[model samples]
Target: MKINHVAGARRLAIPLAIAALTLGACGGSSDGGGDSSDSSSDPSKFSINLDDCNDPDSATAPIKGTFDVGYSAPLSGPVAGAVELATAGYDARIAAENAKGGIDGVKVKVTYKDDAFQPDKAKANGTEFIESQKVDALATFGTGPLSAMVDDQNAACTPMLYPSSSTDAYVDVKQFPWTTTILPLAKNEAKFLVNLIKDRFPDGAKIGIAENQTASGKVQSEAFQAAAKAADLKITEVASDADPVAAATTLKAKGVEVVYHGGVTGTCGAFDTARGRIGYEPKLVLKPSNCVNAVEYVAAGKAADGVELGAFGKDPNAPENKDDAGVKEYLAQMKEAGVPDDVIGNAVAVSGWTQADLLINTLKQAASSDDGLTRLSVMEAAREQDYASPMLINGIKWFSQPDLLTGIDGFRPIKWNAADKRFVPAGDVISIRP
Candidate 1:
């Protein structure tokens, strides 16, 4: 999970500092000229007019300058395995895009920061990118960190896209017009999980739910309850941040036939360990948030066997996807980027690639539009584009549906095979409505 900044990072940092200083010279003087409600206090002071594509050539004219983007995620934390793999995915995707002469000739430059999964740090990083760096858009990971940056996003008027959080709050079309998600909503995931459970355990299995004590976790908790009720499953108990062993023991004693873990992947690991120790193996279904292809978790030896995981993309190691063009490209890019083999299957890495794919495609659409290169135009393009990538689920297309702000509506079911050390498709891609 070590990042090799050495000289490449320094080269990127210098230009960003210079650009921020140059942009700031005109940004602060808007005290008298513009409306206070807009993201930019003084839109009139922009160095380059975003309304007109400076290139008079054509709709597909090569862009004249660099397209600035910001990225913030946990690079050092409990979820670093996921974050770091995702970060590499972003880098690999960007490299592929840039190699193709970039989007409409404007090379994208990302100012990446590590938020350490801290709310305050996430906000600070978001502020620095939007206000100081003056980036066109910001990409974030995780619900907690994304929530922390909402105010910063509105203030800067910079569009924030591809937040991996499935929380409904992130998709408020009215409140956060500048924000949209790339993943399915948590409630939608809940519905899909419940459907699977109903079909598998037709007799109405007794279920126990466990979640974190955080705000996002609470939202997931409620979604699970509603879904469980819809499926007519009996609820034995619900625990928040309780000792995994104790909780598992209680649920086992109560004859709970299944356990739904609604927290981080670590929580899932804890529950599995507890279940193994107690010799009670119930059907474990994880919310998409906790469902991932973490290397260590996969290597844990039978802890995750038969554990059903919901995700929006194909497994990196899936035999069917191995020869697919997109998966091959992704693997090649990761190898070229020096991504470690052990961390390649992390699900967040797929998310990172999806994020990059959306960003590049949206920028291309915006750059080629009648109203070109403006932040507003980019947001509009993001909302309008029916983007798809090689790595997304077989039938899923990014923003394929017009009504959904979060482009993805479906997820595939994957099961961990501890003996084989890989994830195999558990079922077909399942789409759920909001």
Candidate 2:
């Protein structure tokens, strides 16, 4: 994925984009109170009209034998290192599930493809999976690629299960009834950050946000700004790609007491390093969940120390979690799958494992339901999920409703201990109950 490196002037367009993507059809209430209507009791209400697709039967058809799934990920791109681990985790989980006789005695088979994190390639892969291959469902990683193919998935009425994206597009159940994601919503993340800032600085502190230029980055930045405005917290904004040293000086001069970077890994490291070099110490330095990797933060050295991260899963590599049964089982499974020891605890890999587990559980529910293991039943089961996975943080449940698009609405805040080169619990899990 190439960095956009857009100018600060581009910030003006973000609010408009947010209005279209966030406030229009794709997002929930700005107050964080999700749709209260209970529509899950009737599965028929969730069914889509598939008259326009090439083969609508694929969406309504039942499996006679094997349950086929088509998945695509960035297996050969700049993000491949982390994404491939997600693929490995997915493969390992599928293997484990098969050994246990699969979902309701029907073996689950996944056809994997490498999208290379390209939108066009991902769209092609999605079309092939739904129109040609006629797979039962679709799953993939990356927000851009998923956004590219979402229309096709909805058109075919194929269940697009557990796509790894933070974009608000997946949450518009009425617009894209076939799609749902396991990733936390950027809006929710913004709300969480705002609440944290208020709690840490009740007297109020000057805030600054280093906004990334990508579409997803813009969404996050706008979300935080919106939440902050709602809470009466003012924020100064900076482009994430700005000269880090200059950016640090400007922020310090502006009396910014807290700095939040909702961007990619490289920029996060650069900004942290610059702040350290310039001796600009903000009261709080925060990063998104995706930037929690040790290797990515290593370039920032001690500058990365004390940086807080928002995450949903327990870090398997953290020494404190070494005794966790879920962490132990994850390690054992990765080892069993012949994964390199060094790659065992990668966060993206853990997410892949988490997504696959969700898929397996949903399939089991669909298989046992009165509707039987058809595409409609699978989607119905997915929309009504309310369970806890071993891999997620304790007491943090994964759930969904017909109108609630996000599976997890909270994060477990962790801080990077640069000296220890691992993440440790910063505070209790913070969530917004809808």
TM-scores of the models, in the given order?
0.81, 0.84
Show pairs that collide, candidate 1: 399-407
- Candidate 1 is scored at a TM of 0.81
lDDT per residue for candidate 1 within 1-434, as digits (tens), equals 11111121111000111223224332233344364322134332222122222221222223357877788877788777666767788888888788789877778888889987788888999888866776777877777888999866854557787776768876644345468776677787888888888888777777888766655567778888888888777678886645877876787788777777776643446666666778877766455544575564555467668777677776687778777888887888878878877666667677787788888888887777665676655665765655568888778777632223646767778777778876677888776533
Candidate 1 Cα misplacement greater than 4 A, ranges: 1-64, 265-267, 400-403
Name the lDDT value of residue 85 in candidate 1: 68
Per-model C-alpha RMSD: 10.8, 9.8
lDDT of 2: 0.73
Let me know the TM-score candidate 2 reaches against the reference structure.
Answer: 0.84
Top TM-score prediction, candidate number: 2
